[model samples]
Target: MKYLLLSIFLCTLLACTPGSATKYPYTIRDFPDSLRTDLRKIVNYGFIGSPSYESAGNIRMQISDNDCKRLALSEHPILRSLALDILCNRHHLDHYSIMMQHLDDTAYVNWYYQCASFTFITVSDFMVKEYKWYTEEEKNRTVEKIIRDHNYLQSAYEALHKTTLTEAHYPFVRKMAEKETLMKFRSEALLHLAGYKKISDTGFLHNALYQSRHELDANAFGIMELYQDPFYFAMLKKYFPGGYYRNFCKKDFERNTTENALSYVSALASYRSEESAAILEKILFQDPLVPCFPADTFRLRQHLYEVIEKNTCEHYSKMLRVVKPWLERERKESAENGFPIDTTSFYQFPSDSTNPPKIRW
Candidate 1:
């Protein structure tokens, strides 16, 4: 018993040693103590309501220029991202040069937004697109290089968006749209071309949609929304059929499911046909209502009403028939729950029915 206790004591002591079982297990031996402290905070960042949650400013303040440069080279993608962010915050002339060092880093970083996060964005492609450090001339030259090399095509694709694309860029963008394996990159290229009204032939669009059978991503959906093609109405209906809608409205189907469902709804609203209206009517008025939280329910309704109101389809009035009574029921429910619904700012309900109330809060 005495020997066993001693062995257990030694194990715990070894476990508690400085480098052993560290929260950041990756070796950060090169950074100085103060910088290491800051890096530690950065390494553990993005947890909701945790002390590790760091804003950009807070991160920038602690990391020196020297420290940031070193951090930019970190094998750890998150730390490397921190270095890029700090450099971006500096707004220095040389920030772009330092950023170019890791422009090819395909290391995936999980980016957090409130409680939700996208797990797929690489450290290289995302943040650089957002910064405004490049000149119009510089942007053009860099985009040309990115396209010519094909090594940095993802960054090139993103840079294309910020610059005023010329005739020179269209072929490259279209080619990237054709060849890139990533759905987002392909869709993004298509979306960019569509934005410029350059997609006279939608063969590329159709092929891309066919490949994206798993889930029509946001950029692909953006194209459908832009063209408002009658053909995609049938496709959208097929993609978001009755079973999908039933699964989507449940409380458990929060997060990205909500966004995906809403995208389909918006696409449906784009069409002016009775078929489009019927799908929406079923969504808003049919059984198994959006059983998300009250706030989430409000959000879905707000989006539905705004889109329905803007649409000029013949079924608009038919679709809105339940609006007044629904609003009244919501008001009654709110009052009963001690959070009364205020004046409605969302839908201007048809005045034909005894002065319909608006919903704001």
Candidate 2:
């Protein structure tokens, strides 16, 4: 009986080995020699020395520093590059967040205020599709949080600025305003004073600050939709001066007016109005690149095609006339380059697998 059991166990072990039909398939390609060697060193130093290294510093610092040292001694170019990026990011976590946030904020303001309503709609659609990782509840909560924080910051700034405006606490306000650390405080105060009758009115003004606040809120929503997080915008504001936001918007307006006009054309195409379609053709004739931003251009054209498909033959004709040349050029380029052009659409809806599907005419 013991011999029979031992033989059964041996057979079971052999049955589970790779290439056996009973074994699940997995890919286990060998790592590059340099990467394999460095990986081994990292494991050895990280795990084996961890107990002794506990006295060193934070876990992040110790691991990154040790890994970097090992990478420096490594001869593999790719591994060295990867290690350097990891070390740099680990070392400058806050700085990277700040820079990315500023860029995002700047982009948000420009897209929100200057772009056509259709552009906003298309971009919003793109953002939602691009960041479908976040659950609906998560997205809603994040947006609400951002709005609440923005309101709080705006209120605080208004209180400080009101004292300055009345000259009651002018010197203190001036001093606080001069410090770079308190710039958001100062700007919010100034904005509050400029927009509101008094400190008591700050809440009311924020609640009803129709165009500017709404535009800002929309931009924030756009960012949240794209990134699935609100922390990025705060980080952006932390690094770049708030003054840059206004300046960036102004520059985008001046440089992108023609582009914006083209967006209007794309919007007309989507709406399938004969008047707008005629205007689009004129614009397309003048400048082949209408909506300059690649993402915007792709989205605009897509919406235009969708409108054509669902609405009328006129829209279909208009789209073909306007887009055929571009599509043909793209196809030729894709063929030459051996890469497929991506033209995909995404629609978002609640997932309830247990519920029956509903049909609509």
Candidate 3:
């Protein structure tokens, strides 16, 4: 009961400007009673299609240290999430103390992720809802600006990475980095911040590559990519035998257009290590998984090989011993019979999955 009341008070309290008694635009009550009822319904359903995104006016109320502490203690996921966003927004050195504690809580993992999921759905989702008020013409007409303005997910990450994590928070971030699951972008954002501040735990990162549990498909890989610290040659094998490649590649690779595969290759080539060359060579000879189109992949292999050849000459000798004969044979075969037309356009491959699926369409 206390938890419920606290939740209600906090939810309501979120509307107020922090450190000031003044409510800048208007309280939820300022809306017409009918509109307010409709707004509550939209909030309840967990969608943000209603006029509320605009109506809310990007209200970011401050969370006082007392309230920040209270929020950290709440068992409720929603409040826990709110606490995270508030701390990120506050950017004070003091908030680090509580955030570090949450980072260590095993149960708090999902709660932090849920909070990270965005305290609000982005305009991208809103455009899909196509509220009559927002989308009379095609959303394409104005969505670019709208999206840039309303990306809460980006805001959450920026707020987090931009804040300084003092020695108080360093131990905690390191602890979370050791085993935190499925927190890709923000995890890297924080990791990069840690790197900037020199709060490193390279040993933990090296060990984490071998552990497989994940929250999202890209979590571990993304952070590993971010560190490029004491760069691991084993990240090359993740392209082949790494736990992430097997588990998430099947489910998520088709979506990444095998850039996930390329990611491993890119990181591997970056190391220029013998092990990196060997792993790429091992995978190079193998057939691709079901979702992978062989024709496109043939080019991808060519691209990766070139990367390795350029980056690591010492190891390239072994690769050349085998690859030179294979390329000659392929050329001979092409001359004997016309080359199989390249169905996969290397030009068409996405550099990254930055263009998220369209919500407005």
Winning model by TM-score: 1
Off by over 4 Å in 3: 1-37, 40-45, 50-181, 190-194, 197-200, 207-231, 234-239, 242-249, 252-257, 288-299, 318-361
Model 3 residue 267 distance off true place after TM-score fit, in angstroms: 2.2
What lDDT score belongs to each candidate, Candidate 1 first?
A: 0.64, 0.36, 0.45
Q: Report the C-alpha displacement of residue 222, candidate 2, in angstroms.
A: 11
Residue 67 Cα positional deviation in candidate 2, in Å, after optimal superposition: 32
User: Per-residue lDDT of 87-164 in model 1, one digit per residue for the tens?
Assistant: 865754476576555566676776664545444566766555545543555555556666655434467666566567
lDDT of 3 at 121: 33
Ranking by TM-score: 1, 3, 2
Question: Residues 193-286, candidate 2, lDDT per residue (tens digit)?
Answer: 3332345533433333222321233222222223322243332223222321232234454332223222223333443456445544553443
Cα lDDT tens digits for candidate 3, 1-361? 9999999899889766463333122333544453444334434444322233342223224334555455434443333344454554454444423333343222222111132343343322222222222223433433332223332333233333434445554544454454443455445434544464463455555555554333323435555555565544444453456542443344443343444555556666666667667776676666563234333566666666666655657776777676666666777888999866777755775555654343322
Output the better candidate (1/3) by lDDT. Answer: 1
TM-score result, candidate 2: 0.25
Task: Check candidate 1 and list the clashing pairs.
Answer: 344-358, 344-359, 344-360, 345-359
Cα displacement (angstroms), candidate 1, residue 9, comes to: 48
* Candidate number that wins on TM-score, 1 or 3: 1
Worst 10 residues of 3 by lDDT: 104-113
* Candidate with maximal lDDT: 1
Off by over 4 Å in 1: 1-93, 107-123, 126-163, 179-186, 196-200, 242-257, 291-295, 323-361
TM-score of 3: 0.43
